[model samples]
Target: MTDPFFLCTLLWFALSIAALARLRRRDRQAIQAQIRQVGQLADETNELILFLDYSAPGFKEIDAFLLTDMPGRVTVVFHAPQWLFAAKAKRWERHCVVSADCLNASSSGMTPTRVVLDKGGKYRVFYEVPAFLKLWSRSKM
Candidate 1:
């Protein structure tokens, strides 16, 4: 038990465990902050922010929307819906992947911009439809 090799290995293991615990705590706090931001945005907008799968093949929709927007068009950024306050944020973080068809863009007469949060809650992507094409693309979405 007094061997230097065993002592060194035990010390390394203890340090590694401490480092891992610190990293985990940091990650948890970051996730909480992200959730708070999302919740606040959702509350302010009072609109449903559509969540999409960033890893899918059809994720090009956000890119298309970005390209289609006119250079002069104004942009608006809004947050999540009321239901996402705090309790449901965890569920949302766990299960944000959803089909685009879940939303009916035409019912509102205007195509509302789409908001997507990354799975890690580290980034947000917004897809704004152009004013001219709002009606035109309303049926397409």
Candidate 2:
């Protein structure tokens, strides 16, 4: 009775929404568990840590822009407060990066954080975006 194209589009739309929701839920749960283990209450005052995930093909084939996934690369970021940064240094939680080394790489979008994994200016700068929103918004001016 209905156009096949329309039905396919509808199904894709529903699937897309579900995927987004699922990603959000999974990300939130991971963050919450980390916060709990780190002994920090999830509050609005200050974010204890922020998680950002860069999904792509693979590291070797990852593009500088990170807009597409060709060979498959995923760089997950775990950002933490300055004071507590050292405490999490040894944990194999994720691709962890200090807040000092991260910045909002977008003019828009839900405050996605781009963390530089390299220690100093001497090495190649890797662009990695985090998945969660931090408590404080940077570059608001």
Worst 10-residue stretch by lDDT in candidate 2? 132-141
Candidate 1 on 1-141: residue-level lDDT in tens?
A: 499999999999999999999976664564345345545544432122343334433335433543453222221222234443233334334223223333322223222344433444454434442332344346445
The model with the greatest lDDT is: 1
After superposing candidate 2 on the true structure, give the runs of residues whose Cα lies further than 4 Å from its correct spot: 40-141
> Candidate 1: misplaced stretches above 4 Å?
44-141
Alpha-carbon TM-score of each model against the true structure: 0.36, 0.34
